[model samples]
Target: MPGEAPYLAVADVLRARILAGEWGVGERLPSRARLAEEYGVGRNVVQRAVDRLIIDGHLEGRAGSGTYVRSPRERLRLVRSRHRERPAGFPLRPGTRERGRADAWDAHSQVRVSAPAEIAGRLDISPGDLCVTTHYEFLAAGQPVQLSASWEPMALTDGTPIVLPEQGPLAGKGVVERMRSIGVVVETVVEVPRPARATHAQANLLGIGAGDLVLLIERTIYDTRGRPVETADMVIPDRHREVVYEFGVDLP
Candidate 1:
């Protein structure tokens, strides 16, 4: 196309060649200077194209060596099951075991944080209301697989042992168990999953291209009385995982 960016045009050609197997997996690509001369563009243009390909998972860079084609990675299965246990020690909904073995996760919580408008809407609370906010990173085999930001109304757990989700005796216990300890019986969970493009920050954390596809899930947990208890937004990189939804069938 006329007026197209020179780097993008170079990237398109390089991508096509890689897809056509001009460069086999693990095969090193020609030097950036050579590519620049061939494409009649500056070395910077070739460098930009190679950088994009690296971010897109089509290539890998080596220190003191040239870039090489990357091998395809197997995507892990991340299951979201309605029947999974959400007790004190079990994972909530998308259990870590679904991805294979025991996955590791770390969470940081801030007390009395003001809820943003979107989070407030999901929790059915007013904007700027006090809330306990938690940011989580889930890892599989020491690689990041998922990220989540969760919010809980402070009014519900004020002065309670479960006020700080990752603190107190119930530390690391799931939302259901923690709420139960405070006399709040969790009844139902609602999740809305959608496709999204990774932002630069998300891409950096997930080790994927900035515009790569990711699964965005908006989840909210409700109490027995239908009061919203906790809400969260989860981000799963499409390059690394496939999400599956499972529900048990009841017989009449």
Candidate 2:
């Protein structure tokens, strides 16, 4: 416990130094032995301190280089947009009314063949369930802005008439809309946000570099009776997409 205490103390000291600008971005930390001597702790304690900093994103370690402070820009500050309108009718570019057709959902590439654990759990389905997934990358000025994937339950969609890549644009009709036409009324919409990495397939689908920053927005559509119907995962590039929220308050 005492050894761990020193490590924690050293971690706090270094974290404060990082926040106070004692170590600039990408600047290397002192060597383990040097840090141990500086902090009057053993090398292992110093190493633990450094590990904690790395996990907290205050420090980074390069394979061939030493531990260094993380760049401030690497810290993502998510900005949600304030606009709320129809979901699927917006043009690929701003200020235009071009219709994005279902054809746009065609399989330009296969990102993940198996349903990821998180997605499967959200959809109340099994992993690797037969799902047709499409990766859609929206670009602005030739850079990837947003990456997203729409998934359908194999039982609900497999062999169904809607599985064709040509049916892509229809997926955005909100599962509720699509279901309503089929006499299924979606009663609930649940959306959750978190940080995640792009799998190999997702990287290929979105045309983003591996391990790049992304925002995972998971949405689950449920029927009127509270049965989960459809789930979608939207990956937004840190620099490309904006999130928005609107609040309605009752006047006193």
Candidate 3:
């Protein structure tokens, strides 16, 4: 459209004012009446303009206080290399590459759990088949940053020393390394990433607002024979983190 609405036009100037540092982050905007007079618009128009900026994430409203420029969120990067999660000590393997190396992690595994149909399909097992399910919460700088729930068929690791994901000698060692201990060679990892809104439970766990954006990662680990040995769903708060992918380029 050649001409924006009256309120939208006012919003544009107000946005420009904010971006130009007229009102810094966490600084309150002038009263609606004040802005209305300065912009030669009605108070309702000024209020609507401010509301639009709030919806666009440029501003936030506080109880009994005027709207203020939102503080720019500090986001950390969570990287996924084309080839990652290989067990340590593998010949020709690169440097230490695993999850949560930069943070602390807590994991709990429940044994003899029956797999649901959806999980069974991913693991290529019958519905209600026995498996071990593990829940993980990762903290970066002492704050919750990531969450995941992993599943592994008990038929493959029932009596092994590493059967429990977070307990035993190989406790907390990752799917690849534990499977390797039992002679199952892990060769591939596949991840599907999607955008999702934070659920109430997820919002509480990650300490974020409900409906906040998040990255949902559905990941599966496979063996050399193309059998899926483990599957996990990873969650990261989009407002607090960004996902980065890295690939190696080889010379011909």
- Model 3: ten consecutive residues of lowest lDDT: 92-101
The residue-by-residue lDDT of candidate 2 on 1-252, one tens digit each, is 255478999999889988999888878887888988888888988898887776555787888778999875332223333233546864323422222212333234342367788777877789877665666665544544566666666666555545533365464564555667655687767778888766676666665445655679887878887767667777865433435433435699
Which stretches in model 2 have alpha-carbon errors above 4 Å?
A: 1-3, 74-151, 159-161, 164-183, 192-218, 232-252
lDDT of 3 by residue, 166-197 (tens): 88899878788999999999998999999998
Decide which is better by lDDT, 1 or 3: 1
lDDT of each: 0.88, 0.64, 0.85
Order candidates by lDDT, high to low: 1, 3, 2
Pairwise TM-score winner, candidates 1 and 2: 1
- Pick the lDDT winner: 1
* Highest TM-score against the true fold, candidate: 1
What's model 1's TM-score? 0.79
Candidate 3 stretches greater than 4 Å from native: 1-17, 29-67, 83-101, 250-252
Candidate 2 residue pairs that clash: 80-243, 80-244, 81-243, 81-244, 102-169
lDDT of 2 at 96: 29
Write down the TM-score of every candidate.
0.79, 0.58, 0.75
User: What's the CA RMSD for each of the models?
Assistant: 4.6, 7.3, 5.3
